[model samples]
Target: MRLPKTAHTSRPWRIHEIAGDFQVEDVWALPTPGGPDDLAHLVDQFAQGKGEPIDSPVARALFAIRWKLGALFGWDKPDGGVGGRLTSLRGRLPADLREGPKGPDLTAAPFTSVFQTHDEWAAEMGNRTVHGVMHIGWVPDGAGGYRGQMAVLVKPNGRLGALYMLGIKPFRYLGVYPALIREIGSEWRARAGQRAAGSAGAAGAGG
Candidate 1:
């Protein structure tokens, strides 16, 4: 569910310190509800490319068109990515965050993990369009449990980046984000079921 901007901005997230210059592009109430410790699990699943793929046929078509357009326009080349045309936020991390666990290594995803604290995890990605941060936070649901919240922060590169962001805004909100959220919810339910089955097996063995 798309959340109000204040859902992220009103909080005391560490991301606010470093990403002051970036715009809060989107905030969403993730469907992965669980205990506090499950934040890391969610982060791991994301880093491993578990639910990031575009599953909807329309979304997949859009992705295909976008990638083709990127290739034609040299939008996703190495020269347009982090450490080339753009700088990584890792260079701006304080000493403590720099030396701490930088979360998991991504294999097939565009994002690379930045930092993983107790209740938060962040990853970063950059392309010709924009340099963006994906932040996952664990927030209490007032029922003695917690749920996941996600915020997208982006610093658009230049005129091209700004235009690109504007172009994709509608597709993202209507097609891509919805598909991705549904996939994440499905994966979370599957994982929860597996854990329950494992626990039941152990209990039966003990009995």
Candidate 2:
């Protein structure tokens, strides 16, 4: 579900430190709910799964079209990405975060892991239009269990970036995000079902 910006800004997230130049583009409550330690499952699935739930047919087609246009326009060249046209946020990490788990390696994905803790994970992706951060935090639902909260932060490249963001606003809000949320919910439930089945099997063995 879409959430107010405060849902993210109110928290003392490490992202706040580096993303001051970026804006909170969107925030949503992820469907994944579990104990604090279970956050790893969500992060791992996102990082390792080759075909993520967010990559539905329409989304994939949109992305393919975008990439083709990017290639044609020189928008996605290496120089326009991390460590070339843009510097990575990793350089700004404090010593502790630098030394700690830098989340998952996502060579196969568009994003690169920035940092992670028991309750939080962040990754970054960029092209000519924008440098964006995807942050997930395990937040208390006020009923004792924890659910994931996702926030997107972006630093636009220039006037082009601003215009690009404006152009995609409708599609992002109306289609992409909602589909992604449903996918996350499906994956979350699937994991829960697997755990329940395993537990049932264990109980039968004990009996």
Per TM-score, the best of the predicted structures is 1
lDDT of 2 by residue, 1-207 (tens): 999999999999998887788999999998887876678878877876555446477776667777788888898888888888889999988898889999886655689999998888999988899999999998998889989999999999999999989988987877688888988888778678765686679789999
- What's the CA error at residue 190 for candidate 2, in Å? 1.5
Give the range of the ten consecutive residues with the poorest summed lDDT in model 1. Answer: 45-54
Backbone clashes, candidate 1: 0
Which residue pairs clash within candidate 2? none
Q: CA shift at 202, candidate 2, in angstroms?
A: 14
**Runs off by more than 4 Å, candidate 1:** 50-52, 194-207
Candidate 2 C-alpha error for residue 161, in Å: 0.4
What Cα-based lDDT does every candidate model obtain? 0.85, 0.85
